[model samples]
Target: MTKRSFDQFFKNPRHWREDLVAVGGDFSVDRLLYAYTHGIFPWSEDPIRWYCLDPRAIFDIHRVHFSKTVLRKVRQKKFRISFNEAFPIVMQACSYREKDNTWITPGFIDGYLELHKKGWAHSVEVWNAENVLVGGVYGVAIGKFFAGESMFSFESDAGKIGLFHLFAKLKESNFELFDTQQLNHVTWQLGAYEIPKLSYLDRLERAIKDMVPWVIPLSHD
Candidate 1:
């Protein structure tokens, strides 16, 4: 495989078959840099395929839909949410235990840890009444854009709660965009839609120009 510059990313051919078929494959720094900067991400395991779909789904902070059911649950105060309190454990749980497959390999973890230390990554964690972690989500923040990675839940509705909390907090703090990468039934139900890949990159470019601090002081109770 040939390496390419960030500017040459869109021109490079995407051959998933060869690019990520090997076990324990690591995305080169340049490749990963290109991926995120271009609104694409590696989301598969085994033969990890790089994905960049047009009409990508994202949640505009002002437009994030919060279901009344979820809001009612949040008001009930049954669970607690915390931010940046348990980064590694939350990420590991999101990968290893809840998801039968994982692309967040050791290398990915270490790389993201470096990102976290650089203040480009963050975590939002949820815990049950017993103060046991039940769900969480993690992602990288580039300027005002947050590229969501993955979330996992160990209890009923925990993941949704975590997402709701994160959404509300981010919106309240005036973030411009929350990139979900890809959308599924749950995300679609909770209000996620797609935009063209090129359009998505344009949005990312604009979003990443704002140096607003991702200042979401999540409540920990």
Candidate 2:
């Protein structure tokens, strides 16, 4: 992929038309990191028409909705949660969910795996009482921001439980924002709200400067 200026290539995500900075390039580790750091993420319907998205809406860390219904399910704790235990498998499963549009192609998977190995990507995994992997969430974490990419569940409420735990852990770790790329029904129900690009960028700028310890280390191969 050709090198693009992240600042120039990125603007708050818009859906009325294609709002992309650059397209048609390789998925290199460097490109991916720069994109996420600057609030840009890739999306393509056909795998060939890749576009970077930095949506206008974001999940305010303090405003995340935990509905009584969802909270009740979360409290039931039908599953156990772990971190980084099965990152690859969790990511692959998240890539292919029935009837969902996927940007997590093989190349994207390889790119994120590289990010994981570098400690820039991480997973929150949920397992059943039988010790079977059931649900999980994954995203890119840089500074105090954890940009939620996707999630999946093999059983009822597994993903929701995983999300609840993920938020709990993020709070403990002092993360500033939980960025969900665009406004959707799922996040709407979860309490994410849309903010204008100007405000989002301001918060994003401050978020990138928080020097809290990353949830994982970047030392190994």
- Per-residue alpha-carbon lDDT of candidate 2 for residues 46-162, written as tens digits (9 for 90 to 100): 443434344466776766887787689777766778888898999898987577757787887887888888888889899988999999999888888888989898887678788
Clashes of each: 6, 1
lDDT of 2 at 150: 90
**Candidate 1 lDDT, tens digit per residue, 1-221?**
34443434443323322322223334554455556665667765445466666557887766667678878888998987888889888788877754366778776777677667667778988998899999998987766788888888888778788888877777666677789877898888878888766677778888878644366664544
- Count steric clashes of candidate 1: 6
The whole-model lDDT of each prediction reads 0.72, 0.73
Compare the candidates by TM-score and give the number of the best one: 2
For model 2, what is the alpha-carbon lDDT of residue 198? 50
- Give candidate 1 regions above 4 Å deviation: 1-4, 8-34, 44-49, 97-99, 211-213, 218-221
